[model samples]
Target chain A: MTQDETMISVRNIGKRFGSVVAVEDACFDIRRGEFFSLLGASGSGKTTVLRIMAGFEAATSGAIFIDGRQMDAVPPHQRPVNMVFQNYAIFPHLNVADNIGFGLRKLKLDPVERRRRIDEMLELIKLPGFGDRLADQLSGGQRQRVALARALVLQPKVLLLDEPLGALDKQLREQMQVELRALQRSIGVTFVLVTHDQEEALTLSDRIAVMADGRVLQVDTPAGLYERPCSRQVAGFVGNMNFLPARVVSQDGGSARIDVPGLQTTCSISAERLARFGSDISLAIRPERMTLHRERPADQANSVSGVLHDRMYLGERTQFQVALDDRGTTIAVSSSTTVAERLGSIDPGAQVWLSWSEEALIPLGND
Target chain B: MTVTSELNAPAGADKTAFAGLRRLFFQNESLRGLVLLTPTLVILSITVIVPFLLMGAMSLWTQIGFDYTDDWSFRNYGIILTEPLYTTLLLRSLGMSMAATLVTVMLAYPMAYFLAFHVQKNKLIWLIIITLPFWTSYLLRVFAWRVVLGYEGVINTGLMEIGLISEPLSFLLYSKSAVIITLAHAWAAFALLPIYVSLEKIDKSVLEASADLGEGPVMRFLRVILPLSMPGVIAGTFLMFIPTVGDYVTAALVGGPDSRMIGNLIELQFGTVDNWPMGAALAITMIISITMVGLLFMVLSRLLKRWVAA
Candidate 1:
């Protein structure tokens, strides 16, 4: 992206809390008006990165810039960024209107304009006439909306959200996710969200930075990260993937032939992933991509015979755990319940065949 | 149908009777709570309420020589309102108590803040140390203050020995400032604990949120910390002020003739003056005035909160 497209640039930022290294040499650029997510598990330092960007924390090394202005000397309040805290931190003593209008005080707006802005924010958050209600009077979802309104009312260049929807119930969380994405799109504000929920990140983020142990493992679009994870760790973290030990037979140009001992077949990997990580690699396949059949299909190049060890009936899809002839390896295959019904009564102990296309077998870096 | 209705009537009556009794004493939470508090109510009525009512009754009667007359009159209250001695002493006591409360709260606030925010370990030890002075007798503490402030006492002796002063100062010991200082020291723990509890109850995130919203440290404290800690401040004020207003021992020991407060006058009427009715009237007046001042402070603090929030 060009300099104008880059809204916030975090450059080689590192933070150490006494003996613990919270964030180590993290570098990334958030594009303007993009919904970006730092996705990680707990202790992955995603929140720390968001805090540093917001100027709540000063990096022990390197620097952060917002709109090409160095933020090292700026305090959080003075920075051109606002944050929606995880707990929503609505001032309990103030009514909803005052909470939303808090940042407006620093702007020194006239009463008419301030009221107009606050009312506009309340309406945007779907909370008209809620200005008179106190913080304690608000429910969890209401508080979340109020927090969003409070931060967005300032119209900062960038808005940071630290697990903004982590506190809601599953249903409310899903609904808010859709609403939040729509809100971000309509306002065209760069939203940098920190979350451990992969589904939430995948659904809401335009681009995701996968973090682990205070290091950025990969930065890609959600589909790119899920479909073509650069490392085995990212693949495992992003979604369920069955790994089978594979040996590279040959490599030419961008394609490589790999032998999967568990599947008992040599499949062509249409990518040069084995060259960088060497011959000892794992063939990763999503469960849904593998098809299960009772009879061996004649045209299939990659197929393995196994016995169904377990069957899980998930409402839309049924997952079957298959034990191959190889002693201790089990691979899961998921099929639509409609297809399972047409296949006619496959018991747990029944024999099954699993097959997939060559493009489904992704050669992942072992490291 | 008529036979079935008649058969159900006795069972329904029995159920209603049991439910009524249960609702009165057990089913309703407030009524159950009142039932559980019966013992405390009885004890308080006997020990406090009965004596207070008797005192109020006595305040309207006249005391003649050794025996008290049964004639009920407002003569004691009239004397209290008309006599300059009673009014002056009451006003002096009010002023001294207010001064003591101000000094105590101001000094205790920093200590409470330190204990709440800064101290990470040995908090219980610090709390115990603060209350250690209370373990000593109250009279002993007053006397210790006397020793510290008296002529040729700790302050005078130390200053003179160091060649800072030519002679011992006589004004330090027998003065209103001495009484105020002693009362403030005695009530420090009372003021500190309530303020500390309030400050400790403040969610740390609220302060961080304030700072994040563009408020500096001073503004954050004024907007968040002070308002949130108001309950403890009010509690501490009442804790220090009400008791100090009626304190007789400290005034008697540290205060000279001019610094004597209404408590000393009440003590004189009850003891040396042999005027029980007048003493009762003075006590009643002190209680009423203290209660009124407490209510006024509460209202003022609430208004201050609203103003600051706005």
Candidate 2:
């Protein structure tokens, strides 16, 4: 991305709360009009980074730059960003219209223009007739929409959302996720969301920064983070992966033949496919990448023999726990229910075969 | 549990009737509740209701030379309506209480706000400290104020010692301001508690939301904090003002002849003046007037709260 495409440049920001480190050396650039997300578990310091960007919390070191202007001296109210708090924080005393019009107060727009703006926002949030409804009268999903409309009515350059849909039911959360993406697209404003839910981050973001233990582990697109994560932390967080101990057998200029004793296979992996780290290297494979078969597949290079310990029939997929013959190490294998049905039923203690392509093996880094 | 048992008390119903009544007592929930409340009701009827009824009856009767007159009349109320002394003292008492209520609420608001927002530790200890003054007797508190505001009291003596005045300040005591100041001080805890409770009930995130919406600290307080804390403000005003309006002890101790209130006049009629009917009438009149003023205040405050929110 060019300089103009960069909307927010966070440079080495850190926050310490008196002997407790909250965020340390966080650095990332959010592109203009892009829906970016900071994905982490609780206590990963994602919220702290978003707060710093919104000017709610000042970083103990480094600074934040929005639209190429340093925001160190700016207060939250004066900053060009607005936040939708975790609890929505709808002013209880005010009705929906007044809540949305709150930030418009400082603008001092005429009455007609102000009403026009508020009505426009209400329409955009699909709450056109909810102007007279008080905060407490709103349902959870409606309150989430109203919060979005309130922040958007200010015409901020960036919108910060902190677990905006965490309070909604599962069904409502999925609906709001779709609507949130649509809203962000229509407005074409930079959106920086903080959430611990990896699925939400993947579905809503153009790029995600995975954080752990107050540190940003990696920043990548959803597909990139899942397929080519630079570290073990990002791989495990984004999706489920089984780690297999591997050793280097030989190395060429562009490929390395590694011995994965757990899979009972030796495969040649391209250099770009490995994130080699730690004293002993380990390779990761997604459960869905491995195919399970009753009979030995002929001429398959990456094949292993294991015993079927158990199987779980999920609605969309079937999960099998296979213990490899090498050391009785259990590795989870998942396949579509259709594929598992085609192979017939397999009982516990029955022999089975698991196979995968060389491209499925991803080497993880220790850090 | 059987409804038919009520219709059949039995032929030899002596013991059977008693047994049936006991079963009814155990079965009827509301009956048990009424029986449980009888003792409190009996005590209240004797101590509060019976005296109020007697006072109401006496307020309509004319007293003749200490002998009881059963004939009911409005002669005492007519006197109150015609006498300038009654209305003057009544209005003076109201004005003083209003002044006192205003001062108390204004002073207590900051203390309550500080307790709610700034003090992060030992909150209960601070609460106990503010209420520590109430551990002293009410009369002792009034006398302490007299010492602080008397002719040669703390303020006057300290000023004289500093050579700021040629003579002691007489206005410091035996004046309406003296009564107002003492009343404000004496009832401060009543004002502080309600204000503190209301302020504490406010969600801190609402204040942050206000700041995020581009309001500075002062505007946030005015727009958010003050309006949200109005319940406590209204409660504090009522607690301080209503009781002080009928307070005789404070006025008698610090107020001089000109600063005498309606409470003092009513006490005089019942005591040295030996006019029981007149005293009863004055008490009834004060109660009615305060009730009306309090209702008006409540309506106005509700309107103000809604207006500010709007």
Candidate 3:
């Protein structure tokens, strides 16, 4: 992103809780009008990073800048950022309008202006005529919207959301993901979301920062992170992945000779896919990229023969767990349409060959 | 929604009262609940409600041989209220109780808030220490204060030995201030526990939300913490005020003649003066006054809630 369009820049941020490091050397930039997400599991330091950016937590050793101004010493209340907490945290004593207008009340906005903005926000969140309703009277989705309206009504330079859809049901969560993104786009303010669901990050964010064990593994666009993972951890985290350990035998012209176990012939992977020679190498492929067939196909470059160990029939797709002769397990997910047309039917202990293009299999670094 | 509403409707308004009675006896969980609570209710009625009703009746009659069956009259109430000394003592007791409750709450709120929010893992230890005095006898606790504030006590002796005073202070143990100080120390835990429970039950995320929305610490406490804990404050004040008004030990032990509370006066009327009717009337008056003040607090809290919301 351009520096002029950068709204919040986190530089070398880290946090420690007693002897446990929560976030380590975390750095990312949020564009002025883009929705960015930090995706990780529990205890992966995603929330700690967001809290440091929001100034609720001070970084152990780094700086946070908003609009190019240093904010290391700024307290959370003084920072030009507002957060939509995971629990919605709507002030229970206040009605919906007062909750939405709470921050403006602190700014000493005119009473008439405050009322107008509160009404506008309630309508924006599609809760018109709900100003007098107590927060507990609202449904889960309504409370989430009220929280969103409250955070956005401040018109802060950056809007931080911590698992903003966590309280809603699955359908409501999906719906709010779209609505929240659309609202962010229309408001033209930078949005930073933190979630553990990679699909949520992919669906709602312009860029995703995948975190694990208090360290950021990679930060890229969702497609880039999924397609071009830099490490084994990222590949396994972002989607269903299959890894086959291999040894680099030779290299020439964007293709490399590799000895993949469970097959007699040495395979040729793209030389561009290689990280370094003599490293304990592994080939990574997404489950959806590999195809299954009952009989071997003619002239397919990378083909593996294995017995199907298990099969799962999801509503829209069929997943196969295949066991190789001398190697570990590999899984493949195929749509039901292919199950009807190509393979006809599937069962355990059936012989199958899994084939994929050389470029589809990404070679990941040991690090 | 229709199914749930139908299922939730109270059992058959169309049914006969006898059928309703049968349903209550045979089918209702609430009846079972009441059955389980019957013994406690019986005990409370015999120990508390029956005596309270008897006192209410006695307040309206002339006392004959410690009984109210002789004559029904409001003469005792009329005499008690008309007496300037009695009314002054009643008012003084009310004022002192109010002042003591105020001082106790003001001191307890910060300590409770600190324990609830800032003490973290060691909070239960601090709470136990705050409540440690209550495990001992109330009379012993009052006597302990005598040692702290007596003329030749630790405070006076230390000050005099340090050459800070030529004489031990006589004003420390027998004045109205002494009564208030003694009561405050004695009832400090009573006021702190309810407030602490209230503070502890509040969602810390709400405070975090306040700060996230740009509210300062003072503003957050005023707007969120204080109002949310009003129920506890109301409960603590009621807990302190009701018993303190009728407590004779603190007054008799720590107060001078002029500082004697309504409890001391009532005890004198019943024990020394042989005026049972007037003492009953005074007890009735004290109960009514406390009930009125408690109601006023409830109303004030409700009004404050509305005012803050508005």
Question: In lDDT terms, which candidate is top?
Answer: 1
| Candidates 1 onward: DockQ, in order | 0.49, 0.52, 0.51
How big is the positional error of residue B115 in model 2, measured in Å on the Cα after superposition?
A: 0.9
Per-residue lDDT, model 3, residue B51, is 89
Displacement of the residue A10 alpha carbon in candidate 3, Å: 1.7
Scored against the true structure, residue A314 in model 2 reaches a CA lDDT of: 93
**Scored by Cα lDDT, where does model 3 land?**
0.85
Model 3: what is its DockQ?
0.51
Worst 10 residues of 3 chain B by lDDT: B8-17
Compare the candidates by TM-score and give the number of the best one: 1
Q: What is the TM-score of chain A in candidate 2?
A: 0.97
Q: What tens-digit string does per-residue lDDT give for candidate 2 at A302-359?
A: 8988999999999989999999998778999999999899989899999999999988
Candidate 1 per-residue lDDT, tens place, A47-105, comes to 99998887778899989999999999998878888888999998888899999997787
Instruction: State the lDDT at B47 in candidate 1.
Output: 100
CA lDDT of each candidate? Answer: 0.91, 0.90, 0.85
Candidate 3: residue B81 lDDT (0-100):
78
Candidate 3's residue-wise lDDT over A146-215, tens digit each?
Answer: 9989988998989999998887889999999989888988888889999999999999999999999999
Off by over 4 Å in 3: A253-255, A259-279, A324-333, A336-339, B1-27, B63-69, B305-310
RMSD of each: 5.1, 4.2, 7.1
